[model samples]
Structure formats: structure tokens, C-alpha cells
Target: MNSVNNTDAAKPAAGLSINKRSRSWWSAPLREVLDLAFPPRCLLCEVIDYSSNSHSGSYCSECAEQLCPLPINRCLCCGAEIGLYSMSENGCTHCRHRNLRFESVTCLGMYEGPIRKAILAAKWSFSAVPIRSLGRLLATERREELQLLKVDRVIPIPQHWRQRVFRHFNPAWIIAEEIASALQVPCDAHLLYRQRQTRAQKRVPVSQRFGNQAEAFSLQDMHVVDGERILLVDDVLTTGATCSEATKLLRQNGARECHVAVLGRVLDSSA
Candidate 1:
């Protein structure tokens, strides 16, 4: 009986030995706690954990260095990649032909490579942290541009109540809220509402997306936005249709001016 008791006592030490040999036992929980407490590394580089409550992952400094931020010389209207320009230039070719409702659209990066992947993953996967990180990045990178616009409010392109019921979250709301907090501007999410459920814009052709969202939005409380320089926000901008439609609604409701901000901007060949 005494021998048996001693043998049982030895088992715990053996288990501890095994745990020490593997190293994973310690790292798994340590990683979890660290991830929870610290900013996670970037997904692209996997070395720098950005804890800004916006970005997460393991990618570190090198990954940030690898990212290709949007060029400053891009056309103000279409966000198209362009060369050095004079201040007097009226508008890009696409803008000249299209007569857009929004005063301008500014984006953080081209909708390709890491920027696009991050936006897609954050949207489809319900990864709020990454979207927030992208939003903060936009705020930091475009501070000068945002200051120039003198935006008064941050209005997220709202999700319809029906879609919100299923998706459990709104990506645009996440972005807008973060930007609003960073910029010290008020976020007026309830000011705009999606009156109808339009099919997901991804499946539709670019030409048709605008019409699809033509009547998708309406002002919920015009007084909130009246006489304000509104900043409309979204995760990605493909055809400018979604933003344009939202702009028209804001204008109709008496917003002083509307400017669009996005994390990713799709490369339109036409521009």
C-alpha cells in the first residue's frame, strides 16, 4: 500500500516533465494571455503585434514596412494612381465625366495585395480587430487630407436591420466608430438607414451595382446631419456607387457637404 502511494505521487512529476519537454503546454496558454493583453502582430508580417485595439496578428515591423501605402499624387476624385500634379488641376478624367455627388473620396491603400486581403477577411470573418486597425491606419495616414476636409461627423454606411440580424455585426460601423473616436468627431450611425436589402455588391457587375443601391438608403434623422460636413465611411470602395448613393441621400437631407473615406479602393481600369 505504501509502495502504491509513492508510485502515484511520482506520476505528477512525470507529467510535469512531459509538459516541460514539449514546451507547447507553456506557450499555448502564454500565447493566449499575451494575445489577449498585448496588441497582436500584423497578419501580413507576423512579427509586430499592433495592440491599437484596431489591428491584431503576429506580423511585426517588417510587415508594416512591406505595405505599399497609397501614393499622395493620386487623383482626388477617383483615387486613381497618378503622377505629380499641379494644384490647379480640375479633376481626373473619370470624375470629369461622372459628376459625382460626394466632394471627394480618400482611401488608405489600393484594393489589392495585403490591404484587400485584410479588408475581405475582416468583413467575411467578423474580425473586428483587423477592421479597426485598418481604420486607425486610415486615420493616421490621411490625417492631413481629413484635416483639409474639416469633417464634422463620421457616418457609417448602415446595414439594413435584416442583414444586421444575420451578420451579427457591421464592418462599416466598426471602421467608422474607430475613425470617429480617433478624430474626436461624433459618430452618427443612426442618422442613415438602409431602407431595403440590396444583394451583396460583390456578386453583381460594376455597372449594375450603382442601380442596385440606387434606392437602398434614406435619412433616419435629418436634423443630426443638417449643416454638417459629413464623412461617410466604408470598409472598401469598388465602383463608388455605394458611397455616391449614400452621398445623394445625405445631400437630399440637407448635409452641407459629404466626403468619403475607405480602407481599400478597388483599381478601376477606367480611371
Candidate 2:
């Protein structure tokens, strides 16, 4: 991974930043003791044979290497794999006429294989873990790409009040805080609000996802994003209707630009 040079920025809340305790003088010895008490295991593959990396770091090298890059020929607009370049126009046929709203989108890779496995674990199995372990893992994995977006602030796609109560967490919010720290940009989790609970995009057909999310978001205040370049963070990018809707609100409220970063992107062959 590339080194980050940004100065430390104020955190969104406690436990959102990488646990600094891991860097403490007592941290190593404490982790060593814990390792002795219970043999270390790979968090992803669950192997018991592992050495000290970080107190929270648990993936083995083989698992880490599974995070491959997106296809070289991709839509410059949305990061979807569009096969080899077909023309001077950068975006794929589906997106050529549609305004994506965001300036650009960065994704770890196609939503399959190891990255997909990790995202499933993050969103479904382990919401209670501090920092959302899968999010912290992916955020650390994708830090370099995120820094290059050069956005002024980070905002997580907001969860409606009812969703948060049911899920007890927002994976995007946790991922946003982890990324905002590395980018050294302020993170504002409250910048957007979900006015209505929309149907999960995964449950709806790709053709209908855009309309499902169209009226769900509202900018908290016009003055908050006045002339700001914002980075909208989310767990995954499929049809991208979610981010586009949120970006539309932010842009309408005076955000100068909006870029997106997601843990994974689904390349829709069915579309």
C-alpha cells in the first residue's frame, strides 16, 4: 500500500479511527500476551497460525493478495468494467447519456471473490465489532486510492432512523471515518439525511433501483456544503443509483463536486 502523508484530522466519533492503542508502547506486549493465551487466527480464513502484525490485523498474506484491481478497460465515469476501449468516449453505452452526478467513482474491484466475501461479512455478520472489522480492513486496503480523490470532506450515505434501529450500525459510516482519517479530511456523518426508508437495492431489479432511491435523501443544510468538494462513501456500488441520488442532493445544495469510493462494484451483465 502507498504511504499516506496527510496530517491527522479530527475524527467523526470515538472508535472510528484506527485503534491508536495498537501503536502504544504497551500494545505489543499486551498483544503478545493475548496471543499466548489464545493462538492468533486469521480473521478472514480463520487459521490459527499467524504472527503479530497489528492487534486488529488478522488476514494472512494469501488472503490480502486476493484483492485484485478492477478491469483496465472501465467506464471512466462509474468504475464499471466496460471491456476494452471501444471509442473516444470514456463511459459505457448505458452511462453515456445519463449524468452520474458524481465527478468520478473509485472501487476496489468487481463485487466477486474475496472482496465480495469480505463485504458480505462486513454488512451481514459482524455489525457489532468495533470499527466494523471488514470496513476497517477494506478501508486500510484502499487508502491510497481514496487519498487520490482529493476531496475536501467525507460523508457517508446516511441510513434512515428506522434502518439504523434494525441493523444497529451503518457500515458506510464506519468506512467513511476510516477513509476520512487517511485522507486527512474532515468527515461529517450528519451532512445527509434519509427522508424515507427506501427498498434495499439488492432486493429490487436493477432497472427499478434508481426510482426506488430517488426521493430518499435531503441535504441537512445548504450552508454546510457550500462550495465544498465532497467524497461520498458507501459499502458497494451496483447500479450507483444510491450515490447518484445523494450526490444530486449535495450538488443542488451548492457542493462544488462529489466523488465516490466504494468497497466493491458490481458489473451488471444482466443490464
Winning model by TM-score = 2
Candidate 1: segments with Cα more than 4 A from true spot: 1-40, 48-59, 68-70, 86-89, 269-271
Tens-digit per-residue lDDT, 65-118, candidate 1: 444474667767767556676331466754556556788778877777777676
CA lDDT scores, all candidates in order = 0.72, 0.73
> Who wins the lDDT comparison?
2
Q: Write down the TM-score of every candidate.
A: 0.77, 0.81
Tens digit per residue, CA lDDT, model 2, 103-203 = 77777677888878777775775434533555555567767766776788889898999888888678788778777766768778886889999988888
